[model samples]
Target: MPQLPEDMVLPEGFVPSQAPQPPAEPRDSATVALVRDTDGGPEVFLLRRVLGMAFAGGMTVFPGGGVDKRDADTSVAWAGPTPAWWARAFGCSAELARALVCAAVRETFEEAGVLLAGPDADSVVADATPYADARQELVERKLSLAEFLTEAGLVLRADLLRPLGNWVTPPEEPRRYDTRFFLAALPTGQRADGSTTEADHAAWQRPQDAIADWAARRSGLMPPTWVTLSQLAEHRSVRELLAAERQITKITPRVVRRNGNLHVALPGDADYPEAS
Candidate 1:
């Protein structure tokens, strides 16, 4: 298990309750780690969420968000692995698997301006700048991913995504999410932008460098992001990283009190049993 920094402080408004309370249900969400091969190694795209956001405010994260209701639409033009295949991969129902995949693609576009869909099944959009208006509409909930793809005559390229893992927010958290993480190579010609209102800064950083930034206290990384970066740092190239087989499992880190301070404990930690 990866270790959290000793100086780490909980996010704003994340105070634990004084008395035991029922854990809030976690909302289904998707997150994508966009990557590209670099001379130095594989670099993953990350966005620093604006400090005022209710969830992971001021933390750097991959492009992703909650599954939109329309993301589960069966009418979405899709290519590559079927929802059933994805269902088996994530150990969820096919309907939810479809929604998760669609959410991954849609959120990637809305947050990063990178579209994984294409006009035809065999190709991906070379440039997404033309769909700026649609991106806004999607963000504003005025358009569903299926509606946008159908009108644009494109198919969601499921082949471009690979399941990374699933993480459920700890029950102690007032706001929680059952977030599925996916990895996608940055499309060849599409450039990612940080224009979304959710993030104040965006950039591509080599995974190890990101970990280093966290170590030096220059950037904030939640446990999931930190662990993902550590895992990515072990691979030498994008192909290697993607081709590496992953045994998808659910990892729910728990928050515990340790020596009068709050700490996050992974499954294997000694204090994990005390979490709640």
Candidate 2:
């Protein structure tokens, strides 16, 4: 986590340009932690965001983004839990729930070159390279998931996703995202590549090793990513991890001023539990 700028020095003759505005409304978003099993353990696919991006710039994060309006298209071929069941799991309307799931699948494919779709619900694509043209179109928003799947005669494998948690950006941040985190095992025979424009690099790393790198200051990670990775580092196998159920809770940290110092406090901070 980056240090809070509570002790920055001000210029001698600095003048404020404008009054600070209230935090923006949190936009609905979805993130997918793509994991794969290795002889050593489970490793997750991670992307290092480019420095020029607006949010989480230069930070290592899971593949995800804001929900697209087209993501809610009910006409898209879907196989697995119904929108109503997803609504119950995610604590949102059926429409928004549909969009969130679609965003998760779409963003994962866009960022990691892994598509959780296939000819039917029970199957997954053996190779995703054939969809390279559609992937580009999806990235450019020239084609929606519905359009691509419809044309390709594929169905969205909604069962591949497992609900993890929900987090809202702190109220003080200029950009806020009401993000829902999801976990999915990487599809068989499909490889993830680091070709997205948003990321400078992407790699598969064991959760524990990623945490060690962050601790050693070899990479940057936001609080959510760090905390999630810590939680994931405990699992011994991807199968066991995916089989487990998650208790999703909304965590929005509060900015607390204590003894002339500033801190972002989580709900259970009294014990100051070590994340890893």
Candidate 3:
């Protein structure tokens, strides 16, 4: 578990008028850890969310968002692993597993300019730049992933994704998400563009380099991103990283008081290194 920051301090003379509101419902979402091998080491793609966003603003994170209703559209063309396979992998219902996989692929294309879909079960889009218009439509919610794939005759490559873990937002947050994390290799010939409106900038950085940036306060990383990078930093190549087995577990932070200061605590508090 990652270390949590101290609780916010309220201004003097500020009194609560009503009891605290319950935490927002946790929305079903998916995030992708897009990685590739480079001369230095394996690098992961990251996006700095626009500061004005409602959640995790200005934080470096993986490309992902809430699952769209259309993600569950069973008609979408798909190749590779079946929804049932993903269901078992993610411990989700088959129906939701389909939506999660679709959401993962869709969000990756919309946010990172990488399409995990191909013309057929075996062919992936060598270059995704040609589909900029479709990508925009998807971002705008004007185009459903199912519709885009059907019109373009593409198949969702579920085989390209590997489940890493799941995370649920802490109850203290006003907006929450039950997000699933996935690992995927950047497709051949496709370049990730940092053109999404939601992000001020995006790029690929080696795991250790990103951690160093965070330590220097040059980049902001949420607990999940920080911990994930730390784990990935141990691997020198994407192949080795992916070949390792991961036992997925859910981690939720809880409020605790220590030394007269309120702070969030996660599992293994005494041994867990602080990432905040």
TM-score of each: 0.96, 0.89, 0.89
lDDT values for all models: 0.91, 0.85, 0.83
For candidate 1, write residues 1-276 as lDDT tens digits: 456666665643366554238778899999999999999999999999999899988999999999888899999999999999999999999999999999999999999999999988899999999999999999999999999999999999999999998999988778899999999999989999967999999999999999899889899999899989988889999999889899899888887777777777888787787545
After aligning candidate 2 to the native by TM-score, how far in Å is the CA of 102 from where it should be?
0.4
Q: What's the CA RMSD for each of the models?
A: 1.6, 5.2, 4.2
lDDT value for candidate 2?
0.85
Superior candidate under lDDT, 1 versus 2? 1
Tell me which residue pairs clash in candidate 2: none
Ordered list by lDDT, greatest first: 1, 2, 3
Model 3 pairs whose backbones collide: none
Regions more than 4 Å wrong, model 2: 1-21, 257-262, 270-276
Q: Residue 274 in candidate 2 has what lDDT? A: 38
